[model samples]
Target: MYPDIPIRDWTFENVSGGTTGEPVKFRHSGKFFETDQGAKLLFDEWSGRKIGDYQIRLWGSERDIVSGKKDWMNKIYRWMRNEVFLNTFVMSEDVIKKYINVINETKPKMILAYVQSIMEIVKYANLNHIEMYSPRGIMTSAGTLDEQMLEEIQKVFKCPVFNRYGSREMGDMACSCNKNEGLHINTFVSYIEVLDGNYESCNLDEEGQLIVSLLSDYSMPIIRYAIGDRGALSSKTCTCGRGLPMLKCVTGRIIDFFKTMDGRIVYGDYFTHLFYPCTNVKQFQVIQDAIDHILVKLVFFDKDVDNKGFYFEKENEIKKAMGEGTKVDFKIVDDIPVSKSGKRIYTICQI
Candidate 1:
């Protein structure tokens, strides 16, 4: 820590990759935002959202919009871009009603949101018979977006949903194009390398830890830093004709993997893929309390629906994947809490 460096000298305030572990705070060159903005403009343009296009961002906190008088600068920025910022902290019926009203009226071109937050909005609209405004496309980040969740979001919004991948420390790394073949790497800002346990390049689609080198950060040089996530790079190119490289998948954090009693390591996606076909389930989380005991927390669309049979099936399914020695307990909840960074960690390992 450089205690002698004045706080004013450091330009950007950024937090470390804490989706899987503890968070660390750091400062960087003031020019970092400019570089990120340039990268984002390109990413958004690829998805049909131009710089001047009206957009809605579902990313601000309640304090940011509590009173227009309190944050005059944000209000002016919103006005200039014709954007709306929905609060993720409060999604009560009253709050959602206000969001629906504003969205229907503005009719923005794009809706950028955290995956789970947007899913919750769409779920509420479906459950309460609330009408939604149609945007050119929806872009989601900050959490994992499985196939089932993607289908539900697109079905409710009636628009193409693009998945964006990145972190606070790495800025915009990859995003899906119109083709949706896979996420294209932002080779302009960062150099990404995928390596196996032996630290060798994985062939084609083999899963490995993502080591990123930030080319833009000169004030605080970061080279081949493990951002604490698992993914794979595609040897194939995109069909959309973009020369940008592709990523096969960005599964959840590597630390979330659970070790079974039999010493088998199970990744988080193994549990995520299981609930993909369950339309009745809104969201779920898995916590490995011990080697032989697992706790499953679930949020359903309909609270009254009979999940007894479904639980029985899931028990057997989980047992098969995690080994029959593990016992799983299911608990239905109203909501799943997010981390301090406003992202959801679907899998929690107590071991």
Candidate 2:
């Protein structure tokens, strides 16, 4: 829908499909080249995603725009929006259950799950003494999670929940290393520039918007495109040293961080690694409405999870973070809802 490629006269049928020998020429947005590059990378990354030849079929459907129901415009609107959002959000129950079962059976050392449901799994891991992977920053949703929210996500686990960021347009862009707290930009695929308010190069320690030039897409080349994030470049390099780029003070989206009674800051990355061996958990989310009131939303594996020592363990840990006098609460939600876009925000903060 967005690339806006014009269909040939023969493609005017209700449903049309085709094969392209070369990249699509119509809809050459700046990303045409980069999309090409990413396409190759994607092919290599998930070589088995395609087992045989396939023809991409494009069609139009109607939607109830007023009630946000499905209609032709809505059908086109959905795919026109973002290619990745559609894939991430509208997954089948069987697909979700497959991943859930894999997690339960394998009990991996680390897991990187979305916000709304990751915690449900973490809750289960905690009960079984499973040490899930959690980073020190926000357990951001599919896109970007703000700093304060990242802080709160991390507070759920003693270990840090490392922050990772990327988009369908942009491949894997940045991830915080196990050794360092700073996020390292994946410079192999793209170049990054920070622009000040005046649209000039921002000085070190100065906060500015990020613009990216993707080096990988031949199908879609995005040059000097804004990444919709604000951050400060680090003059001092990191000791962990992967040597791509160092970023500090990343404040793109709004994240709320509150001080507990004892003054500990809450972050999202705090929750990532906290759920590993907790096999009975499905997914979860943590909601903080106030400094004293924190709610734990959970979805379980068997409709009923072992609550035996679950409450006492996390209660003490949370008390340590919020302080001795803070009051905590729990909400057992049947569903930790997903957004219209399908991205799940793990930590919701108000304070």
Candidate 3:
């Protein structure tokens, strides 16, 4: 779709997990990386960390791991950047214990992770009475960070938790400053707007759809892009005195935890990651009907395609995380409906 941007200029190619629809493959130019790095620098400054500080990133990508690139790439990157990666794909008790051990060994100055993933770690740590190395700050992204989750994370880690809001299509757009009042938009690289049903801008503090334009991505300019999120802009200035604009709150991405019969809690994003490579599926929803039952609703691009084999293959993996006795049912549907708020939530826990 982006034919104007030359292939040589595309430095990074990635596929989003498609929380709302089918997976999307997008390319980023070298300039996009520069702006992304700049945004991280701003986050560091706001979080009271300096550049080149040691940090551990709790992130995971099934594609990277399957392609066998994450192992060597992470090793080299860790050596050059003073960073470490602990995959959050599987959150079993053993994995969480390993994560804690890595943190205590590395003693990173900052811990950056997906909100739900780190929340799982904190929950496990608290329950098991496991002590962790306190970092200077914690940065959360990729999921909704509510007030309760934020407070719990701060109490467990004994550090300020900064919530970051962004997407794969657009690099880091807004992040909470040290003031913790709200997330300040990276006005230098992007413009943000909150719109109502009429597609007009909403008043300050009025909840609406978030529309963003990447000012720095000229190669594949994204203008007035409806970013599939609901948020509001703040009217008050931050006490830290940064002139950047702020988001009063982001309330669009809501993912629930899936529980196993054995009392294990799995992050909702794990199921989303499971279907990232299923390009034939147009959209999907995972619903935990009971502790040992899961119902998956799928809308495929071609309704006539045989999907039984796909279902059986993924069913085993789901059961592995949810319990061996778990019953996973896959139903092909004509459409997966959105919520009353016009958002397509990929994961839901009815229990």
Candidate 4:
């Protein structure tokens, strides 16, 4: 649609990948930054996050921290925003303790982070009997937040946990309103639709792959972009009264689902329930190798915690859920690897 836009004017680039492992770069004009920031602020204000609020971002990598330290401009910008970055990639006992201490001291107004990173901190707080300062609200992004994890995060943080669904390729697409009902699409910036395998729109409340069309980025127009996520449209209107359409749920990427022995498809969230309140378990991943065999990789907080009892209990639960015919093997590991996209994969189905 953008015929006269100059390629040199595109100032922003977003790198994303599909299951095939090739990286695709999307370009956007500088104007997109302002529009995106405005939409984010508008949605965040509904959750009581406002300007000049203390924002603690549980994000960043080793490279990000190092770069921030080396570049005065980035450091100043972060300081001006009153934002602190806690490196989610570097999680160790001493590092977590320091993070907890800093958070307790700062008492931030907003806690923005990946769902899993915050969940890990919450688990550490519960285990160490450390009391964290209550923030106004916690806004989670970059990954799907399971119901169990949401409940625990709210319980520990004592704040409304807003789930945000977005991909780097499309920027911020949707966020839950204060009503905590469902994620409202940012209609001003993008058009979103749920489509079936045939590329036709799915009926309301029916699950399908999500395809997005970004209206704000004409410099490199994205039309019906398959974002590789699954979700459903809400049949009911949100009580919050926003005219924007609602997404019932943003199930993670299509690869996150597993096939059961009976050929039934089970979502990642279904297996997530197995580790609710996930106090003892530090991290976990479920791999379905075959119709009859499943491998569970886990990392426990305490190396000496009653492994035998824990395994027995979890094995029974897995059997009950997956079926008695399915075999369950528990292997304790130091850590699970993140995906090539730098996001954690919870479920893997080889079959």
Candidate 5:
């Protein structure tokens, strides 16, 4: 899936999210990181933070934390870069409290984290009326941030919350400027296109699959690579006045598509939208176990809150979308596990 560059010439190997299926590895040249720095520089300039600023990263899982502790070279590298790493996979009350204490003590200038991970922290802090350290800025990636999530995060952090769009295959493809209008494409590192089902370019503000061509990865030329997520290109220029183009929004992963019995495709966002108005649901995951069967696992904030009628209505909606023959089952669980990369896979198709 890449160029004929020798393995010895590659500088880094990264894996895909593997949320829908098996993860694929991609190799990068030395210049890849050099050009990736351009995105960081842009973000720093936009957010009023520098490269050497003290930053805390809420990322990875418990296993990653254990392995990271043994990697002394990495520790030294992070120290030199003025960075701290905190495990965000498990957000138990104790773990959240520990993270809160560390952030207060370290007082990092910036906090970088996955949208869901930081939202968990925000939820905990808000519930306990806990005071959090006010960082200069917060950067969120890996997951989408709805309006509610963004507002809560800003309220708690009292800092600009910047949303970044990217993948392991492509480094920082785009990021929101201080204006927070939309994500500005990292034109220095990538060229982006939003194409419809016909493999033709989508009009401005038209939602379609995003294809990216990496400008700096000469070792493995990834051209017009479909990154699987759906989004749209924007015609409106950002108020920040950056010449870089903008993406209106990233809808969801293309792999989230579920095939119905009659050969129709149901986007996973359909299931996610069902839970949007459900305030009692703390977390949820939808899985297409087979062509005609869907399993919904949910964690509720209040177990005693009876939502049988709500569940039945949602089941009917799912059946309407996936075909009436489709079997929709709901399961209540204590928690849902995050992916190895510490991201919540909201939907999965096991076909």
Candidate 6:
């Protein structure tokens, strides 16, 4: 249906306050078309090359920067560089000393990273008792920054906490609106659809799967891409008065009931309440290393020196939360592994 519409026709403009203006914010960011092609070529030429992900752009330029010109050849030559470490990308330090060094030496008021890593720091501080923050977004608001732990984190850290959501395929973020909890879609880049389990489109008030469509497609056309995340659209408009469509919430990835050792498939919100309340605990990760065994890695310290009270309390609580007849062991480790993008998954249930 959209075959004739040129990709360059799309532009993200600020229509805040219901006032429509010329499209001034024309710049598009993130992985460009040529960059992905270059990455693929390097992977092919190098004998032992490792390819992380593949990106495709629709009708966008392949240059380092988007050109105002509308031409046929948009692909440009570029190099792919893997970002090593967050703190060290600014300067390289070993992982062991990175966090403490940043907190002690740099001593910045607030620090920002992926959700999982920030949670880890919080857990460590709760167990050991330390404070951390980044200059921006220490307090999550009713607008874009609102979150489950936003209030709790604010009470502890007393700073702004912002929530940002997006994916590589979706182009840019669907961040919390500055005006309210409503998520502002990157209406500039992709078309969004909310769908139910039966492949039917969901209404404004219903929970459903998020189906995204990329408006631009020079490198690769992502038409009606079913991103694993679930979310829904909202009927309410913002006080900020932008007439554009709004998204309500991202429900994260959908899951089926996991059959336990007793042959009962369990699915509910029970797991959310388990570890999240360990107020002082900063980060928690559960990895199913074996069929009947799981390993937990946490970064924390305690004045008790041996960390007897908090440690045992956590283990017992986990066993209770999970259920009976399940023998799971928790491994207290100094470090936890994060994905290439620095986001860590809390509960990695291996089936």
Compute each candidate's TM-score over C-alphas.
0.86, 0.47, 0.70, 0.90, 0.85, 0.57
Please provide, for model 2 over 166-238, each residue's C-alpha lDDT reduced to its tens digit, 9 standing for 90 to 100. 5445655666555545666667676777788689999876768878786654444568866555677777666
Candidate 4 local lDDT, residue 57: 86
Error of 3 at 168 (Å): 1.1
Task: Encode model 5's per-residue lDDT on 38-112: one tens digit a residue.
Answer: 777677667667878999989854433555546786677688778888988876668888999999999988988
Give the per-residue lDDT digits (tens) of candidate 1, residues 79-197.
87667787776455577677878778989899989886787678678877877888998999877777778888888888899999988787899998888888999888888899998
User: Which stretch of 10 consecutive residues in model 4 shows the poorest summed lDDT?
Assistant: 60-69
lDDT of each: 0.80, 0.49, 0.78, 0.79, 0.82, 0.46
Report how far off residue 341 is in candidate 4 (Å).
Answer: 4.2
TM-score, model 5 to reference: 0.85
Highest TM-score scorer = 4
Superposed model 1: Cα runs more than 4 Å off: 1-9, 60-80, 93-98, 128-131, 276-283, 299-306
Enumerate residue pairs that collide in model 3. Answer: none
Q: What pairs collide in candidate 1?
A: none
After superposition, which runs of candidate 2 have C-alpha atoms over 4 Å from their true positions?
1-28, 31-93, 97-164, 168-258, 261-264, 275-277, 305-308
Candidate 1 versus truth, CA RMSD in Å, comes to 4.3
lDDT winner between candidates 1 and 6:
1
Candidate order by TM-score, decreasing, is 4, 1, 5, 3, 6, 2
Provide C-alpha RMSD values for all models, in order.
Answer: 4.3, 11.8, 12.3, 2.6, 3.9, 13.2
What ranges in model 4 sit over 4 Å off? 1-8, 17-22, 60-73
Alpha carbon RMSD to native, model 3: 12.3
* lDDT agreement of model 5 with the native: 0.82
- Predicted structure 4, TM vs. truth: 0.90
Go through the candidates in order and give the clash count of each.
0, 70, 0, 0, 0, 32
Worst 10 residues of 5 by lDDT: 60-69
